[model samples]
Target: METTQNTFEQFKLNRQLLNAIEEAGYTTPTPIQEQAIPLALAGQDILGIAQTGTGKTAAYALPLLMRIKYAQGQHARALIMAPTRELAMQISEAIIQLSKYTDIRTVVLFGGVGPKSQIEAIRDGVDIIVATPGRFMDLYFREEVTVKHLNVMILDEADKMMDMGFMPQIRKLLEIIPVKRQNMLFSATFSEKVERLSHEFLEFPTRIEVTPQATTAEMVSQTLYELPNFHTKMNLLSHLLRDEEVFNRVLIFTRSREVAGLVHQYLLGRVVREDALRVIHANKGQNTRTNAMEAFREGSVRVMVATDVVSRGIDITEVSHVINFDVPLMYEDYVHRIGRTGRANHVGQAITFMTFADEYHIRKIEKMIRMEIPRTKLPAEIEMMETPRNEMQDMLREIDNQKRKEDPTFLGAFHEKKAYRPPSKFNQKDSRARRGASSRTKKR
Candidate 1:
């Protein structure tokens, strides 16, 4: 089907919503939005399979808002469940912007924060709710929310939700929600879990798969580098940045937050402009992640290092390049990481730095995706032995130590709150044994 000249006009969106979209600088609808919006507005269950950074949020948020605003009902009409706190907040933000014309209220609930405010927000009555499964369950268990009057239900990032061990929570939530409702399952990939969930939740939903399950974005120029284990990735990264043409907006994906911090420190010392480089990850907290993303979006940051946790639900336009500093263990992650660069039909580049140890993961990714990624030569040290797979844990620990040395505030964020440390059941017996052993040693 041909895309409409103006999706806003074609959908006959309310003037206020259209005006908000225009102000947000979105006139034409993205592919997923173009197809899913009409079906959603028609009160049809939809199974939308599209890649990340494809504007799928708006695809569901827009029509859901329109329907909620026009239709009459109460009892939390719409419930949108996202896999992570970041994604829940993002979806809620989109919904709020789209629902500005009407009196529709959206409440967002997620973990890692106080629940009092969220409870009050729900108590006050909201037309829509976007939440992470864990916090949402907390609210439900407290009897702060009900779904008997729910009109629509949305499962965003369905596959990631399963990966994050949210299937049980989702199943429980499903039981509470009214059976008669419009269901929408939007996922980046159609894995077996997604298909199973769709079969169970949706009732003859209209299926829309915009891209192949393991397909990377077509606009992304993907390449790989066969770097040796001993080669300094920092020097090679600096070499790439020296080109001057690749500056402005570049993202580097690493396997851990510690690695991300190390890369950020390395870039900070050499980039000449500290303001143009930053790091983001799950351990950074919401505020820091939000700030880092905003800086990158405003063109204030030339390079942003991130972990996979921060890779989901992050939408930034005009990202010139995405560099995989470490190969992703999962095949779908390879798709989302590269999807960040090439967005909205703009051409972008993705380069992966691979060591010999990464050969297994690279092969797995290739086999799963059914395509070989083209390889390029490394900077130097071609004869170096691969880092033993068993030594990867030690490498990670060493990286953590290096990050602490470089970043003074490395552990400060985590220090403010104490993690759970359960007491040992044998503490009394162990203490007695230690005292007896000390007395015996003194006699000796």
Candidate 2:
């Protein structure tokens, strides 16, 4: 079947793979897919600077599928590494979905779940292995997996793996994998670390960057709310959710697991649709986290309160909105969080709630994205609560810390005002209740 010169058919993919792409709901090639596929099929290593929810998985997966064609030896022929179990599973699922018209067997291995099932899959036979660095290594050491026959190696979200401190493991994996394989590194932000890793792993790769690194998706309408306190932020979120239905499949990002829990409880307690809310963090069991994410994806759950644990793990693109209940600590995460929405050229929204303490990070995020996040006013219906004493102090401390960074001699502004009242030692509510965060953030 002849397709447009610019379509997936132009890459000369097999009919089975082409049929799978069509069945998988992909009608046209995303910019990254259009550019990256042909190069990958040409057996050139790829350095792709793109994000999830942008059809990037298929860009690398399709070529890998075409090259691997039918299953060969029992050992895996291609290895795909991801930072999180969610991402590993997501990639494996994508490979399965896109290879439906073909006979390639795939297996996903991660640490959170038992390796017994994964072991069985490998023993049964697989052509591709999608895995996290740590678990992949563990499985290899246990003799359940191998990369001896690898034809291609993919690293998705390489920056996230770096942030998760998986460099040591990644270095070791590279040492073991077949040296002659094709290498592909795909990430949302092209940080210096990713650049360095690319040089180490890729052999004169073809560079493909669809958009400027750290740039938000143009289809996403991003807006920020400068709420004074957490309650006001919640009030605004409730207003949008209950009144306006501004978010259909909303992914809410928080800084800590405790806060994720708090937000879930807060919403479940007040919101009429208790069944529509779910939360996940490092604390949740792997199965529970997976179930929550799946529910959110299938629309069984309307909102998912997740920490950075699942920010890069989420694979759905039809998200109506992404809410940053708290500004992220790592500025780059702001890009990944919002990328969850407005994907595949579909328009969506990203709403962030910021307090004074969050202001410092917000400025840094804005600078990284190179565009100001448009500001929106809080609704009059939602009462603006006073900034909690600890939150206020923490915000002031952040400002002071910034000032000190710029000028060594500057004392904290709190020190000059009102005799510097010592914060209450008993303010567990400030520390624990606010997402069960560490002590540093409790000051504000």
Candidate 3:
């Protein structure tokens, strides 16, 4: 099936893969897909620079699925490594959907669950394995999985995998896999580390970047609120969530599991429809997390409160808004967080609640994305509160940090170490006196 130019059909994909692409309703290719698919189909290694929702999965998966014409061996012929279970499962799901008309089999391997089923699936024969670094390595070491037959290898969110400290496992896998296999790495942002990984893994790879490094999707309208404290932020959030038209299918991102839980609980308790709210963090069980995400995807849940855990991983299309209940400490995550909303050419909203302490963090984020988030006035009805004690302390610490940067001698709470002093003379004397008095009394 020799294809002409500029369309997904332009790639000489098999009948089933082509049919799946058509059935999947992908007519014109995304920029990343446009550049990557042809190169990947030609058995070339690819370094795709695109965010999570940029159709990158199809860019590589479509070509890889087409390449793996049939399911023949017990060992996987292709492997995709992701940092999180959600991402691994998502990639697998995309592959399955694309290859629905074919016999190509895929199994997702991630930690958090028993490997018995995964091992059995691999033993039964699979052509593709989408796995996390740890679980994949576990199965490999246990002799239940092998890469000798692998012809294509992909690392999605390579930056994230590196961030999560998966390099050692990735390096080990690099050493184990066949040297001649085609390798592809896709990331939302490029860094020195990603460059290093690419050099070590991909051989003369064709680089494709649909968007610039750290650039947020142009489709997203970014907004900011300078709330004084957490309670005000929550009040504002509650006010916004009441507007079903704008806040429908929302994802709220927080910095920590604690905040994720708090936000989830606050919303869960207030929303009359309990089934419409779900929370996911590191503490949630695998089934719980999966169910929550799945429910959110299916529109059964209107709100999802998540930590950075799924910022760069989960792909929930049709998210009308992404609310940053707390500014991300890691600036890169702001890009990823907003990405969850403006996906697949859809115009979306990204609202960030910035406290006094978050000013320092938001500057870095704005600089990274090359634009400051537009500040919106808080509703006149919402009562703003004073800076909380913790926030005040954080501001003081930040100020001290800046002062110390100017002059190392500047003492801040963080830089000042409490000095240790010996026990007081009076106390020591009192202890000795008491001990002597006790001894005398015992003697009497």
Candidate 4:
């Protein structure tokens, strides 16, 4: 099937959208955009399955903006629900840019900040709302936001929303919103949960899949390094970042906030300049995360250490490398993480550092991607560090848990061992005395 739109003009988008597209330097439509824009413009529900960084935003945003050509009402006509605040903001920005020539007004609603401004924005006027489910519901319950006019609903990163356990809120939203609405659902990978969601959310949707599910981007060259411990991984990361020219504009993804912080601290003033390094995770204030992301996008930050919070949210075009400091347990995220670098058809590199505990997840990720990650030998200059005893035990326990998950009866090496033993003399004497007392009482 041909999924390429040679030019934006071919879609017959309004002159305003075309101008914005030209200003945004979008010469040709991406695969998802090519397939979804026409269907969306035709007022059909859309189920878009494409890897991240494939211009999925524009695939839906352009048609959405066209549908809402001008802001006429006080209430929003379109609602776009993203999984994270960062994504909500990104989507809002994209829409704002696309709708610049029009009178469309977009407001982003998210937690971690006061709702006063969001409420004020909605009260003043908004044609489109880009929000997370919780924040949208909060404002809706408070009667601050009205959804009676919502005729278009979009669920961006639907898989991530499901993973974040936003189903109940989404279901509630569905019940409250007008049933007569156009729906569009986009995801990097369509898992079973997301599939179920599609059945509930979409009505006779036109499914558009630009790539295979969970497949990494073709422009990204993936490499894996099997290390012995966290310390070694850190050392290897430092060594790789030392090459300033090649590793410029890198995004380092860790599985947890603690690991992200550790990696940020490890590289500060050593391998990366203090001013050129930034770290972002859930614990960071919303403003702090926004600033870090902006810096990384603007080329002021050489390296950014972050958790998966921004994996599917961030949309930067010049990222040179994406380093997986820890293999993602949610295997689908591997595609999103690597998709960050190889964007806009630019060549990018995805390097992963896997410890023993992470090997199982790496294998699963490989299976999902349907390709084995080529292993690279660690540089000899970097000395291997010894794994801490506690760290080693944790890895072993994790491995055991993985094994037990696979085999119910498999006892781990750490499982306690109980052997048969005779009772001690003290215990034996106490037992005899207790038996004699009981016999005397019975005779009496």
Name the candidate that leads on TM-score.
Answer: 4
> Candidate 3, residues 1-444: lDDT per residue as tens digits?
865777776777888888888888888888888899888888898998987777889988888887888878677899999999989998898899999998999999999988898888888889999999999999889989888998888999999888889999999998999999999999988988999999999888899988889998888999998775687788889989998877889999998999888888888758526888888999988999999998998998999999988898677779999999999877788999999987777889999997655777888788888887899977755644444567667666765675677699876765567532222421124444655776798899
RMSD after CA superposition, every candidate? 14.1, 6.5, 11.9, 13.0
Model 1: per-residue Cα lDDT over 313-365, one tens digit each: 77787999989999987668888888888887889999998754576678878
Q: After superposition, how far is residue 221 of candidate 3 from its true place, in Å?
A: 0.3
Q: Return the lDDT, model 2, position 333.
A: 92
Model 1: per-residue Cα lDDT at residue 263: 81
Rank candidates by TM-score, best first.
Answer: 4, 2, 3, 1
Clash pairs for candidate 3: none
Quote model 4's TM-score. 0.92
Q: Model 4 Cα displacement at 392 (Å)?
A: 0.8
Instruction: Provide the global lDDT of candidate 1 against the true structure.
Output: 0.80
Each prediction's TM-score against the native?
0.81, 0.90, 0.89, 0.92
Model 2 earns a TM-score of 0.90
lDDT tens per residue, model 4, 1-444: 865449998899999999999998889888888899999999999999987788899999999998998988799999999999999999999999998899999999999988888898888999999999999999999999989899999999999999999999999999999999999999988899999999999999999998989888889999988777788788788889999999999999998998888888989998899999999999999999999999989999999999999999689999999999889889888898998988877999999987767877988998999999999876755546655778877887897899999998998866666431222411224434655676798899
Better of 1 and 2 by TM-score: 2
Which has the better TM-score: candidate 3, or candidate 4?
A: 4
Predicted structure 3: lDDT: 0.84
lDDT of 2 by residue, 9-74 (tens): 788889998888888777778889899998998999999988667778888998899898897778
Who wins the lDDT comparison? 4
